[model samples]
Target chain A: MPAGKFTQDELDQIYAFAVDLGRKAGDLLMERVEQRIDGSDAPQTFEEKENAVDIVTQTDEDVEVFIRDAIHTKYPTHKFLGEESYAKGESREYLLDAQPTWCIDPLDGTVNYTHLFPMYCVSIGFVVDNLPVIGVIYAPFQNQLFSACNGRGAWLNEKRRLPLIRNPIPPMPANAPSQCIFSCEWGKDRRDIPDGNMHRKIESFVNMAAEIGGREGKGGMVHGIRSLGSATLDLAYTAMGSFDIWWEGGCWEWDVAAGIAILLEAGGLITSANPPDDFDTASIPDVKLGSRLYLAIRPAGPSATESGRESQERTVREVWRRVRQLSYSRPGA
Target chain B: MPAGKFTQDELDQIYAFAVDLGRKAGDLLMERVEQRIDGSDAPQTFEEKENAVDIVTQTDEDVEVFIRDAIHTKYPTHKFLGEESYAKGESREYLLDAQPTWCIDPLDGTVNYTHLFPMYCVSIGFVVDNLPVIGVIYAPFQNQLFSACNGRGAWLNEKRRLPLIRNPIPPMPANAPSQCIFSCEWGKDRRDIPDGNMHRKIESFVNMAAEIGGREGKGGMVHGIRSLGSATLDLAYTAMGSFDIWWEGGCWEWDVAAGIAILLEAGGLITSANPPDDFDTASIPDVKLGSRLYLAIRPAGPSATESGRESQERTVREVWRRVRQLSYSRPGA
Candidate 1:
C-alpha cells in the first residue's frame, strides 16, 4: 500500500458501504416517487436553478441530507461535497484536495424524478487525492446497481463483471463514429448564441447525426444518438458496453465522479470533450472531475493492427474532429 | 357486434394471441442477442434500406417471417403488413384499407438491437377499417410487456393499467413546453439543407431545448428531451405516463400502429405532427395510420376548467407551434 493511502481491504469496505448507501438513497427516491404518483405527496413544488429546464425538488434535498449524515456518522473525518450542499453554499468554491472526500449526487436526474421518467439514480463516489477510487450508482427504477473500486474492476448488481460482454469486446471499427451509439445531453445551459456552448453542442450533435459528406464534410453519421438525461446512468451504461460513446458538458463532479470510477475500472477511456490543441499527439489528456467537459469510449477488443487503447484514442480523435468544440466554465473558475 | 367487425370476444382472443406472439418474438430476439454477445452468433451482416443509418438485419427478417406465418395460419383471411415485407415489396404502396390487417414491426429499434442498447422491442398491431384495434409490444431485455385492446384498456405486463399512475394523472401545465419531457428522434433522413426536413427538425429540437425568450420566441425550455431510437417504446412510455409528449415523423405504420392503439386506450391523444390548417377548430384531425407524421400526449388528470382530452389537445397545438413542420414522404407517394 502507498504511504498515505488505504489498502485493498479498506477500499473494499468503502465500496461496500457506498453500494449499500446508494441503494438506501435509491429506496428513499422510490418512496417519494410512489407518494407523488399515488397523490399522497406534499404540494408539488420545484425550485429553478440555472433556468426552468434545470430544477431541484424537496426529495433531492432530503435525500442528500440523509446521505451526508450517514457518511459523516460512518467516517467522521472524511470531507463531503454534494450537489445540494454545493448549491446552497455561499462561497461556491471548487475544492478537491488530497484528503478523502465523498462526492454524492443524491438525485442525479432531478427533472426526470419530478416528471416520473424512471431514468434517475443515486451516485456516491469516494475520492482520494482528487481521483475517484470507489464508486457506486443505483438506478432503482431499473433495479440496476453499478459499482467499482480502483483496480478491482466494475460490476453490475455485484454479480456480473462489466463490459457485460467481456470475453472479447468488439474492436471499434475503422470509421468509429459510423458504427457508434453516441450518448450526449442537452445540458442545463440553454443559451442559443451562434457558437455558444448550447449552440455548439447542438451543432456537434447534428454533425454527428447528419449524413456522410454533408454539413461541409463534417458529418460522421453515428448509428444513433441517445440522451437519457442522467450523466451517471449514461456513464454506467457506457461502462457496461450498451452505449459506445458518451460526450458531455456542463455537469458537476458529483454528477460524474462515481460513473468515472466505474467506467475507468470497466476498461473505458475518458478524455476532454473539447478538441485538443494538437490532433497529431498520440495521447489526449484525461478530463478532471470538475472540468465540466468529458468524452468517454468503451474498451475495444483485440485488433490485429491496433491495441485497445490505440483504438480508443483513434475514436476520441475522430469524434473530436467531427463535432464542434464546446466550452463550459465552472461557477467560480 | 358490428356486422363487419370482430366481436368483443373475437378481439379479446386476437389480443391474447398477439400478446403470446409478441413474447415469442421477444424471446427469439433475446436468444439472438445472447448469441451475438457471447461470440457464437452467425457472421454479422446488415442490409441497408434507405441509407447507412437505415438498416435491416437477418434477425429482423427471421422474426417477421415467424410472426407473419403464425398470424396467417391462425387468421387465414386477415391481411398482413410488416416492415421487412414492405421493404422487400416492389409496389411499396401506402395501403391501409377496410380489411383486418396485422401490422408488425417484428423488431423495432433495429439499430438499438444491433448495438445491444436494450431499447429495441417487438411491436404487434391489429388494424381494422384503417384503425388500430389491438396493440402488443414486448422488450425482451427490459422484460416489459405493454398491450391494449380497443374500447377495453391498456396494460403493463397484462396487470398494471396505465398511465401507470391512473388514480389521477397530472394535468398539462398552462405553459406545457416549459415543463414537458419531449421525445423526438434524429431519423434516417440526415440531409443538411438550410430549411429542409432534417434542418427544420434540428431547428425545432433547438427551439424546444433553448432558454426561455430565446430562438425568436420559439424557445420551449422543456424540462428534457429524450431520444430512445425506438418509436414503439417511446409511445408505450408516453401511454404509461413516463413521457409527457412525443412527436415523430418518417416512421412507417408498422412502427406506430400498435403504440397508437395502446396510447389511445391509455386515455392519450394523437394528432398530426404537422400543424393543422385551422388551429381554432374545436377538434384536430386524428392522424391516419399512414400519415408519416404523429404527435402524442399523455393522459391528463381531471381539471375543473378543461377535460383531459381538451388539455391533451392544447398540448398538441402548443408543441406543433414550437417545432418546425417536417416533411416525410413514403416510397412512391
Candidate 2:
C-alpha cells in the first residue's frame, strides 16, 4: 500500500475511530480495575514468565485480543502489532510501506496494574511508512485521554492542547540551575548484565543532570530528579510541560509510540539517545520496537535573540551531548 | 510545657484547630495557583540562595509566617520550629526537651511550586517532647489533605482511612518478587560527594533492585523504582499502600515530620536508613532537625503462621533487614 497523505475527511475519520477505540479499551480496563477492587472477580492468572512480578495477566492477553479483533473487523486490511501478541511470534517488523499499521500496548504499565498503582494506561499508535501518523493514549483511572493526528495538534480530553500551559513561564536563564527528570525501568534483564552498566548509566546521567557549579564553573546544579515509573505517563506529562526534560532508556516502542506522536504534536522534540540529527525513520521503527532510548524536551523559549524553535533544538542537543559523553560500565565487567 | 497526655477534649480541640489551619493554608496556595494559571500574577521571584532552582520565593516565607502566627495566636506558649524561620535559631533541639512544639515545612516541594507541577504541599506537625503527636499535610492543587493524631488513626480528606484500598490485598509474600519502589533527591550538596561514589551507590541499588531471580532463587526480582520528587507525598503514598516502600537521604525533619506521624498512625513503619527500629520521640526530634536517611514501609501481612505482636515485629524487622541489605550509597561518605 502507498503512503497516502490523509485528506481532511480522512483525518477526521481516523480521529473518530482512534478516539472510539481508545475509549473502548479504557472502559474495558476500568471495568477490570473495578472488579479487581471489588474482589468480585479475579484477574485471570498466568504462569510466572520472566519473574513473578512479570506475570502476564489474562486481562493483558484479553485486552490485546479485543483491540486486535476490533481493529481487524473495522479495517480488515490494516496490520496490527501488539505487545502480548508480539511475544508469541506475532511479528515485530511493521509494514511501514503498507496502509497505516496499528502499534499498541494494550496495557503500558502491567506492573503498576498488578500492584494497583494508578499510573498505568492503554497506548495506541498508527504508523505509516514507519512514522507515527496518529496516536492515542488513555489513562482511565486518571480520566486522561491524549490524542493527535499527523500535521494536526494534540489534545488532552479533546479540549486542552498538548503542553497544558500555552505559554510556560519563560525558560530558566542559561547557567541558571536546571532540573532534569528521567523515567527508566529496572528492566527484566537485571541479572544478566555485568558491572551494572545500566545502573551506572542512570547514576551517571543523574549526576550530570544534578551537578551544581564547580570550582571552575562547570556543572549546572539541577533542582531535582524524579522517576515516576510509567514511561507513557512520563512522556505525556513531559509533553504537558510538567517536567523540563525526560531521559529514558531500555523501554520498548509500544512503551512510547503513542507518546512520541503526542509529544511531537505538542511541539516537543525527541531524539535518539545517541545525539540530535542521528534520528531518522529506520531508527523510528526500532524506537517503536523498543530497541532504543529517547530524550524528549518540552518546547522552550528562544535564547535571547534566537527563534524559539531553534533555541529548543539547540538546548535538546546540548543536553544529549552531555549524556553521551558519560561512559558506563556494566556490573561485573 | 510538660510531657503530659492531652485529655480527649483537648485532643478534639487540637484536631479541630489543625484542620482549620490546614484548610486556610491550602486556600492561600490555591488562590496563588489560580492567579498564576490565569495570567493575573507572575511566577514568584526570589533570590537564589543555593542555586537558581533552589529559589526562596516570597510566598514560601509569607505562608510560613502565617502558619506560625496562627499557631502562636492560638497557643501562645507553644514553641515553633519552621523551615523558613529555623535559621533564626528556632531549631528542633529546643522541641526535644519535652515541650509542646510545632514543626512546619510551609512549602515542602518548592521546586514543584516554581514549575507549577501540582505536587507541592504544606506539611505541619505538632509534637510533644519531640514526638509528632498530630500531623497534617495538604496538597492544594490535588485537593488531597492527609492528617493523623497519635493513636487515633489517619485520614485522607477526613473521610478515608489510609491504605485506602476498599478491598484489602494481602501483604506481599516473602517469596513475592522483591519489587520495591524507592524515592531519593538530588540534594544541594552534590559537589561535596565524589561522582564515583554516586555512580557506584546508585548502580548497586538499581542493580540489586532490578535483578530478577538469580542464584538467590525464584521471585527475587526488584519489581520497579520511582522517585516522585516530594518526600511528604512519597510517605503519604506509602501509607496509602500505593507504594511498597520509600527511602530517602538528606532531607530535614520538616520534610518528613508530618509524613512520619501519618505513616506510623496508619500501621506503617519508619526507621533510620541505617537500621530498623520502632521510631520514637528521642530519635525523631534529632533526626527531624539533622540530615539523616529514613525508610518507611506500609503495613504488610505477617509471615505465614507468624502470630502475636512479637512475631509481627520480627517479620517487620526481617523485611527491613532485607530491604536495607540492598545497597544505596551516602553521597559524601
Give all TM-scores, in the order shown.
0.96, 0.83
Off by more than 4 A, model 1 = A2-4, A42-44, A331-333, B1-4, B42-44, B280-283, B331-333
Which 10 consecutive positions of candidate 2 chain B have the poorest summed lDDT?
B279-288
Give residue A296's error in model 2 in angstroms. Answer: 0.8
Clash numbers, per candidate: 0, 16
Error of 1 at A203 (Å): 1.1
Worst 10 residues of 1 chain B by lDDT: B275-284
lDDT by residue (B1-333, candidate 1, tens digit) is: 631478988898998999999999999999998787676876356888888889999999999999999999999999999999988988767877889999999999999888777789999999988889899999998788999998679998898788877556778877887799999998888877779888888888888888888998878888899999999999999998888999988898999999999998898888888876565464688877888898999878767888887788888877877877788766532
List each candidate's DockQ score: 0.69, 0.41
Q: Could you give the CAPRI-style class of model 2? A: acceptable
